[model samples]
Target chain A: MNLTIKATKNNTFDAVVVGSGMTGGFAAKELTERGLKVLMIERGREIKHIEGYDTAMKQPWEIEHRGKTTNVSAEERWANSRFWGLGSEEVVNHLTNDKENPYIEKRPFDWIRAYHTGGKSMHWGRQSYRWNKQDFEANAKEGIGIDWPIRYEDLEPWYAHVEKFVGVSGQKEGWDVLPDGHFLPPMPMFAPEVHFKKMMTEKLSRPVTIGRIANLTQPQKVHTDLGRASCQYRSKCARGCPYGGYYSSLSGAIPAAMQTKRLSILHDSIVSEIIYDEQKKRAIGVRVIDQHTHAVTEFFAKIIFLNAGSINTAALMLNSKSNRFQNGFGNDSDQVGRNLMDHQLGSGAMASIDGFEDDYVYGQRPNALYIPRFRNWGNDKQTAYLRGFGYQGGASREGWESGVNADGFGADFKKSLTKPGPWSIRIGGFGEILPNPNNRIYLDSEKKDKWGIPMIVTDAAFVENDWAMRKDIIASAVEMLDTAGFKNVTSYDRPTHMGLGIHDMGTARMGRDPKTSVLNAYNQVHDCKNVFVTDGAAMASSSCVNPSITYMALTARAVDYAVKALKKRES
Target chain B: MLGGAFSAPTLMAMNHWEQATSPTIEGAAFSLSDTHRKIVAEIAEMIIPRTDTPGAKDAGVPAFIEMMLKDCYAQSEHLSFTEGLASMEQVKFLELNEAERRGVLKYLEQQTKEKMKAMPKGTPFWRLMKELTLLGYFTSEAGIKASFDYVQIPGKLENIKLKPNQKAYAY
Candidate 1:
């Protein structure tokens, strides 16, 4: 009995974070640094910083397929994902093999996932933008979905705090559409991109700026202290940056949390269930299963944070059923895996630039130009759609890939292939998808993965407003490119599904009422106060922006609130 | 006298093969015969002949092409490629002179473009050959280092003025 008590005590901590991903990394950092003993659990293999990047510096000759996934198994792994470059050898290990982890796509959901220590942070396109005041007010103003319980002011300070630590590199555009944040020096734009931006703003009357990315442009003391440095312009971040130039969980928060010495990490341990106490009416602990060995272990904690991304986070809650909460953990609202939302994308335009062949970029900028949302703003309201969409793209000279169509065969032809081809400008729209109860993911009790976890059944598609918005998204992209006076402008709308954006959100959303939402204003489960979810799952609305930075801010805020509540209760 | 030992194309290919002294690789999945390999090698050279810098054959592209066909391509997809070579063999491609070979490549190129309309999920033979050779050659070390301005790490990302005859960046 004494041995049992000691073992139980050994498992207990101040907090247990269910993932070591983007938000979980921040949660661990915030909680531990605030003097809480924290244990971050991850189902994927732990990646030690720098050294774990197996193919970061591999030359083109060294890669067998030369960046193309021409092999059968590799094709099947990335098939139907619709993401173009994830199949390359450089980042293959970072992606989840689709065959091995198949989700039942009821409506062809391209559910791309990354289950690793850093999670999708390793593979994230680091475009970080703030959700303006309108983004928070959209749902309530338009009656599209449930209102966001907290407004932008609630998250403003948290965003600043997170950005200060994370080192966001961007220009402070004074536009209300994209609220400026704490940022490092902005990365310089290429000549063609600069020309495109000028033309776009001058003609189209829209704001176009260099992409607000999370790369370290100028390393500060806070960044350098974390062993993070300035960007090397190699653009090999997909394989994991050896120099910690960009911010992955491994590159930033995890290390900071480790420095606090109040943090313990568990890799390859999947959090299967959040254990709720019947008497306390709160989450007391969690049940974890070893991803490899399949051995189950129960861990106790005062506070538990679920940051296992949007999909797996909802899955974990739905799987954790008890006598009191028979539906799922914190499912008193019956909204555990509903109100699914993701950004609709993969529609864009490209055009060739005839002149200015006498200019070239020196380094890989590793960022694109951003055209902020213009449609459906205050004065620019449209009857077609409720919310607006932003465009992300840049201009560049055509590389060797363009040579495939050109007639080529000898010394002169080969010489032409070697020379830089005509400059071309491209733009893609990332539009907002309104939250719908039908567009959701539920656990399939019939099927289980190799790890014995229930498989996710995704049923989501673009609805009426979404499709209506997409037509504009495509039209706007082409208009911007064509109006910029580029030659041979062409538009393409590739096959896109809900999860293709990989911005899986609004599953267990935060709202005003516990009856209508899973999480409260502070991202704490309403029925279960000690348990919080600060990942994409907590998003009430799918704002038209890259959401990783928002997740970081929310996670930091939740930890601060949770820790203060814990201390206050003790007093 | 030299034509007696080999075909006319082989006699021409031998002249280029002296630069590509790398031993023939036996692909575990797929590979071509010595005659077919020599024909492909000569085509690779013609596509990117030795200029001021080393050409495709010098970069040992024949072995890389075989490796790509072995691992990257399916048997069904490469069958047309192999059959295309056989068709070329039927037309005495091994005996064709330089100008005739160039015309033959051009003819195959046009034919492949027409066949591409009917072909599903795979490139036609002539298109595949040209693309594969390009893929193999340009990704090779000699192509990256010798031909282009290879920069392993550019510390700055500012826009630089493009000079005359500036080669593309080998990133």
Candidate 2:
């Protein structure tokens, strides 16, 4: 098992960043900008910006089977097929193949992942919200898990830094539960959404605002200088925005990093293990397996950034077995793959609006309206759930496809479909799932992958707090819809497993204590300060919000800290 | 966290995408005979006859359905479809005049509605054929261009007051 792998001297760099995803792209950009020669290793095929978006340029009619997922695709892509939008022929190409990249699921876990250059950044739901002050102190206040080492004030500047570069579009709502950030021109709200917002404010005393999204409403100089454009309003964002209308890694950070001329990226290179120096007690390099030839190569670096997503980041660290740290790299606390958490979803309510038959939006707006969490924050503490949940929903006039199940055919049916149907509004909740030590992922040592690396085994599920929050998610959503004078209001709550949210976090949690956590407040591993995990893996707790922006902020902060630390050491 | 949670509202936006693959209708693998192809084309035309917009037959919906049935549908559904084709052939439905073909379809539609009410498990062949025809036609360029307003990129979101008879947006 001890096959000797020689370190390639030519591949040495100041920093080696694993995974060219949202955080990895940021790490590459920030590190390279800070004067470090950074090497970014991406596990999937190289997906170039704009030109690599094969499905974006395609018209509805141009796609085969009318963009339907074929029978072969359903059988072969069983893991990804369950994801509503991801399984389509128009989008499936970007997703990771389940058969090739298999993982053991103790329970039903929907692990939707894209391993390409941009990773899930290209298809991410760009709802950027800053974690509130209360969110940082929640774990300690509630006595749930270990407290977050850093507070909102610590991350506020970094959040603003990312928001300015990313070009988030939103209105300054002055909400405390969800802190607002630097924003571009907000996308216009639909008439129904406007009505719903008013009703929620008047009746329930909850703030419903247009979603603060990463989609560029108007291209700022920061974005235009990078050759990115404004939003086209096509709503074909998940296909990968060709116009760079959205802030994907492909359109944003990757290009910014390339501009530095200090960043070098290697695609199709899967990081198997981090080469730890037993004598020095630090990570020196990483072993990579070429996805094409299965050739193994070692690239040495002064510092390492593990931004290879949450589960995979844990998997890589756990697989990195050194004589000094036998449990795993920087895992003296035994917290490398513990405390897995994801947002509890698949619960909400919807209703049909009676009027607004003539009102319609002209273009396909990519973003929706978001109701900030009003439960268990400040004076609104709830007895049912430990943490709060937010509602993200919108209203739209039903279009032609409604004719699919309708009775009759010919001219009448054609006319029926041609004219839009009644407007309907619905809101679903993304509830925060409390992190549990038992809900974790580990490497199945007995099962070696195609690259001879151990496969990941996930044992995570929703706890009582999650289900209780889901009930409130449904109840609150229904109450809002009904108060808005919506007819045919219906509440829905379906059982869901972790990873379905695609916001999986908290495996290698950050904390103040080296004995209790894997990473420090700066996202550096406790025992091994040279190696950092700035991705979702380093999250101490899952905040009830989209986590990518926070990850970017953390990556930027971590890189700044690491660069300063490295500079001081050199002096 | 807050953004993608609008799963239900977004479901409407995805409605057009879902039309191509209805969970109830699984396509099958079977070649359409020349005689059966003629009958299937006529049936499609009956469901979406020529009007201001191109009908299902003109939009090449019959061929689309044949491909869908062969590649997307289940084996049991394939047998049911082909057997229904044989029964129609016995009555020489395709050989009849356009008016007579319409009348034949109307009768089948009535039978299908009654059968659906009596037993919900088995979908009537006529209903499946109609659904396929509708999917194929609407997804076709001719059907979309003629019936709905097709805009690849509107560039900006606009507040519009739609007239009662205005065409819906084709994504």
Candidate 3:
């Protein structure tokens, strides 16, 4: 199904954005807001903002299995079957069926995904934090991986810009480790969390504050103008917030992009390849495949933005082989799918508190208490690891789910189950996984997925640096809880494969030298300057923080640069 | 404020969840005999007997337990569970008085404690019966309304003092 010149001409736009997720949503908004006619091609089906959140309002009783998987779902979602609560009736619709979208794992890796319009933004943990000045300099100072082309100063204003629109709710602590952002009033912490925070600061000198979440506690004109409101204090955020309480691609940026007349979108369209013109020395357009019809179509544009997540974005570049990029698109250094990194989790501690028995919560607060990175900082430099880690956790009384193990039977047992159990607090560390060139993803041509594309084989694994940090993560957590006078403190460290954190980054890293990285300072492909990748694919190093907010900031900055470059050329 | 219910965006948002076929309904291969089903129901009621609030029987937990076991469990597991029930039937458990039935359940509970590692998330027969009863009773509409505190939308969030004898929040 080759397109004629007339049809190709009709399909042209000023710019094309691929894979509408966290970054693509912002890219479309930024480009279209600049009066550039942008076309967004999403492989997943379209879902409208508030209305698409079908399970958002569903109560536990409304679900057939009462928020657990049925026999059929347990088999269908076998890959993610071990992930508790993922196959529940309310939350399952927002996630991708792992059986359908298959990938090869050289080492055990969990490829959790959401392929709809908003992508995983619909189901993000919503813990937002900035990668501060220290984070940008860690690689250069340690001489580990290649230096990041851009610094925190380069993204400061862009962070402020996106945070204003995204409506982050956080406490502004003047710590150089984690920079402050433009935040709404932070959500209230639990009483136990408050007590724990006091003890932590007084004893351990670790700053414990409320998590800087993406949920809006107070909606400003910027958010309310887009028809989004404050969070409803309902903890069921993962099902997609009908009130537009928290930020997602569908609830925020995509709607804003569509509000402008310059933005057009096509759904169920997978971008197969980027059309690079050898003579023109730039990307002219992209070739797309219809997800259902298997029909091929080419849409011409002056510039292209690849925001198909980290691994998928690299897979696309590797698959888009041509005369200029025979190895892969702009993969002159063979770095299109290398240096893959994610935050090393699966290590932390939990304890039962003696107090807070008489205390209970009024609403289901969806946020957690954050103990920011204290190690390897100004006053507390650590020999255990190079970078540091932060803790995201909450303290609350144990609910009825713990009753399965509790001893009980008739009326007495039934009456006991009606009330809460012991007050327990749990915290997990999100430690930094260093960018090792050996920890990478390469496309397996021999094994094609259900889509007829090459299955991405993840050879990435946790290195010695990550393991060292994990030791600290567990030991530090136990020490803190024990010192705070908590009862029966227990630690946990499960075997975690990469991609479990879902903050996949550094696949197509941005470095100063074209010989070592795929993208440059402005998030553009080093050789193919017209094509940009502002997702996690462009990350040079894996900082110990949630990466979505950074992706939004970088996408906004890159779009600003790209639009100006286009204008300069036009003039 | 959900404004403009008839607006273009609202109309587009009407894209409901596509997969409506209940997984249990679509793939329920196991069926319990009437005698086996009654004994299962009696065991569930024994585990969570009706007090002031409705027990497992009133909450329609017997049916839920069967549905879970039928569709959710493997054929081998279903056979194993039914075979365990046959052992109880062999003892003429249904003909016993209430006190005798309670004593028999206490003995099975002790036996289950010793052999719990044999079955993980899926379970031994007595443990499975008890677990299913608790799960079905707690999550059902009857349990939520009568036994637990059902708050549809608590608009405010805070750490508050617990009221005496306060019911657990049905999340």
Q: For candidate 3, lDDT tens digit of each residue in A420-524?
A: 777899999998888888888888969887667888898988877788899999999999998888889999998888778888899999999999989899999
In the range A133-244, model 1's lDDT, one tens digit per residue, is 9899988987877899999999999999988888889998899999999989998887777777788778877899989988899999998999999999988888899889
What is the lDDT of every predicted structure here?
A: 0.84, 0.85, 0.83
Q: By lDDT, is 2 or 3 better?
A: 2
Residue A152, candidate 1: alpha-carbon lDDT: 95
Task: Itemize residue pairs with steric clashes in candidate 1.
Answer: none
Model 3, residue A144: what's the lDDT? 82
Q: What is the TM-score of each candidate against the true structure?
A: 0.93, 0.92, 0.93
Give the per-residue lDDT digits (tens) of candidate 2, residues A222-257.
899888998999998989988999998889998998
- For residues B1-171, could you state the per-residue lDDT of candidate 1 as single tens digits? 333645455545444433432232222456788988888887778777889988889988877777777777776656766766666666667677887677666655555677787865556667777787888888888888887899988877877788888898978
Query: Who wins the TM-score comparison?
Result: 1
**Which residue pairs show backbone clashes in model 2?**
A546-B1, B26-B73, B27-B72, B27-B73, B27-B74, B28-B69, B28-B73
The CA lDDT at B20 in model 3 is: 20
| Top candidate when judged by lDDT against the true structure | 2
Residue B15, candidate 1: C-alpha displacement in angstroms: 28
